[model samples]
Target: MSKTITNIHTIDLVSDFKEITKMRLAVSVVFSSVAGYFLGAEIIDFVEVLLLAVGGYMMVGASNAFNQVIEKDLDALMNRTKNRPIPSGRMSVNKALLIGSTLGALGLIILYYINPITSMFGAISIFLYVSVYTPLKTKTPLSVFVGAFPGAIPFMLGWVAATGSFSIEAGTLFMIQFFWQFPHFWALGWWLYDDYKRGGFFMLPTGKRDKGTAVQIILYTIWTIAVSLIPVFGVTGRLYLTPVSGVLILILGLGMLYYAYKLYQSRDEISAKKLMFASVSYITLLQIIYVLDKYIRIWI
Candidate 1:
């Protein structure tokens, strides 16, 4: 009976540690990146796919862990993040830093197993994300642009991991994700502008949810939808999107734009929150659809 109780306590402690590691978010990003790789590959390489999954998970995990480490104080101030392991005293800074560095090193090593270029990119991503993007979040809204560089890499990372080189297809993938991030993140900024301000993070452009910021959100959303359909018109070359896929992409984009437009019209926090949620769903579903469109191997 005592041993059973002890085991339960141990499991709970491990769970707390994982919460700090941001494993769930990392897993989602890894899934999307691997799906991109499989879809983009001329011939799927399981080894490269495996390395991507592992490497991507490690890198993202490291980023989140270090983020928690940096924001421990600010995290303690906010309702949404106050109970995270570092801020809640469930884990110490030293422990988190050690694990983050170890995981980051291991992630790069795994990428190197695929190729040196991949390993180099993985290292650069970690440096930019943890070192630059993290600190800049409190300093300027431009952090969004800086962070976008790392955020956009997963899609093209798939292409690189597959082809051992970058090309038009990779560039197209990068551009699609790059444009999609602005509206997605800006919507989040809209909703969290207050909390972010309290934490000294100038997340929203113009520092307000006014017409100018809304206009930018709506414009970027339009571009996101347009780019998602580029492959259908032979504009993306090797990244062809069929007529049916194009229709679905159009529907997804319109659905997302509807929410963005609504938020723009209202400038209400609740509306911004709705748009933010919709953006998450949009990116996730769009990636799933793209992979499935290819998986079924139908022209449509």
Candidate 2:
């Protein structure tokens, strides 16, 4: 009976860890970094990629854990987040903080082994997410703008990890992801506006569902599509995309834009939800397309 009880306790602890760290989100962030690493690497190093994935996941996990610790009370007020480890009383704040700090330190140390620049960016991402964006969420709608900086870093962080330096290629990757976040997050904000309000989060640009917010989402969606195509023009250095790849990307962007337009026309929760899912699919597919196009071009 004692052994069975111990096994159940272990499983619960693992579940709590996953909840606090937001495992799926962390893995997605790691995926972006890996995608960037592949794009930047001339000769793939599986070991290095492995290190990048683990370090990136740790950094993202740490950021999430710290975020939950800081927003425990606020999270409790929102139905979507109320059941999270910290807010649900499945984990204590002190324990979460300790895990966050440990993961953060270990992540940075691993990144440092990759390169100082990579480590520096990891630290910057954590600081912006935990210190700046987290606090600004309740204060202003611009918090999304602030949060985008950290959110976009993962893709470029992978490039730096591979190249051990910064360049236009890395910057272009950063810009693409940075602009992409505006539309993606705004769609989510629109869909969750009421829930976010309960937590005092001003996520929407206009702080409510209105023509103004929809218009901005449309505008940013256009900008994201434009920035994504910049590589096709051959100006982004090593990040140039072929015309064929560019056309494919354009089509994907148009699909997302179609949903963005639908949201504008309908201005309803269903439309917002559609836009949110479209944006997620758009970015994920875009990254995959970019990586696939690069390899195909190389093969040809």
Candidate 3:
């Protein structure tokens, strides 16, 4: 009976840890970082790539754990986040702080071993996400803009990790993801507006689900599309998209734009949800296309 109880407790602890760190989101961020690394690496080093993945995940996880600690009360107020580890009392604050601090330090140290610039950006992402963006959510809608800085870093961080320098190509990747967030998160803000309101987070530009917010979403979607296509035009160094990849990307962007347009027209939850999914698909597909295109260029 004692051994069985101990096993159950261990399982529960594992689950709580996963909830605190937001494992899936952390992994996705690592994925983007890896994609960026692949794009920038002239000669791929598998060991460094593995280190990058682990380090990126640790940094992102630290940010998330800290964010939850900071927003425990606010999280409890929201339906979507009410059951998270800290909010639900599954994990204590002190343990979470230790986890976050340790992970953050470990992550930065590993990244620094790879390169200083990569470590610097990694630190910036954590600070901006936890110190700036986390607090700004309750104070003003402009938090999204502040948040975009950190949110866009993982993609560029990967590139910097591989190259040990920041370049226009890295900047372009950052800009594409940066602009993409407005529509992606706005749609989410729209879909979860009520939940956010419950948590006192104002995520929309207009602070309401009106034509103003919808219009902004549409406009940013357009901006995202434009920025994504720039490299194909030879504007971004070390990056080029073939006509086939460009067309595919255009179709994907247009598909997302269509949903954004529908959200504007209907101003309804369903359309917002559709736009949210479309945005996710767009980013994932775009990243894949960009990575595939780079390798294709090498072969051709």
Candidate 4:
């Protein structure tokens, strides 16, 4: 009986860790970094990629843990976040802080081994997310704009990790992800406006779901699609995409734009949800296509 009890306790601890760190979200963020690494790497190093993935995941996990610690009370007021580890009382704030700090230090150490620039960007991402974006959520709708700084870093972070320097290629990657976040997050904000209000978060640009917010989402969607095609024009240096790949990317963008337009026309919760999913799919598939096109071009 004691052994069974111990096993159950261990499982519960693991589950709490996953919840506190938001493991799925961390993995997706790590995927973006890996894609960027592949894009910048002339000769792929599997070991370096492995290090990047582990270190990236740790940093993202640390950010999520710290975010939960800072917003424990506010999270408890929102149904969507109320059951998270810290807010739900499954984990203590001190424990979460310890996890966050340890993960952050270890992540930075690992990234430093890859390159100092990578480590610096990793630290900056954590600081901005924890210090700036987290506190700004309740103060203004521009918090999303502030949050995009760190949110856009992962893809470019990977490139810097591979190249050990910033250049137009890295800047282009950053711009693509930066603009992409506006539409993606605005759609999520639209869907969760009421829930976010429960936590005093002014997430929407207009602080309410209206034509103004929808129009901005549409505008940013167009900008994101346009920025994504910049590589095709051969101006982004090493990041140039072939015309075929560019066309494919444009098609994917159009699909997301279609959903964005639908949300504008409907202005309903269901439409917002669809746009949210479409945006997620759009970014993930875009990264995949970029990586695939890079390798295919090399082989040919």
Ranking by TM-score: 4, 2, 3, 1
lDDT per residue as tens, model 1, 48-106: 89889989998888888998999899988877788888888888999999889988999
Model 2 Cα lDDT, one tens digit per residue, 20-71? 8899989989999999999999989898899899899899999999999989
Model 3 TM-score is 0.98
The regions of model 4 sitting more than 4 angstroms off are none
**TM-score against truth, every candidate:** 0.94, 0.98, 0.98, 0.99
Worst 10 residues of 2 by lDDT: 278-287
> Which lDDT tens digits does candidate 3 get at residues 193-291?
999999999999999999999999999999999999998898788877888899999999999999999999999989999999999889888999999
| C-alpha local distance difference test of each model | 0.84, 0.93, 0.94, 0.94
Residue-level error in angstroms, candidate 3, position 286 = 0.6
Candidate 2: C-alpha lDDT: 0.93
Worst 10 residues of 4 by lDDT: 84-93
Model 1: residue 55 alpha-carbon error in angstroms: 1.5
Clashing pairs in 3: none
TM-score of 1: 0.94
Q: How much is 10 displaced in model 4, in angstroms? A: 1.5
In model 3, state the lDDT of residue 135: 97
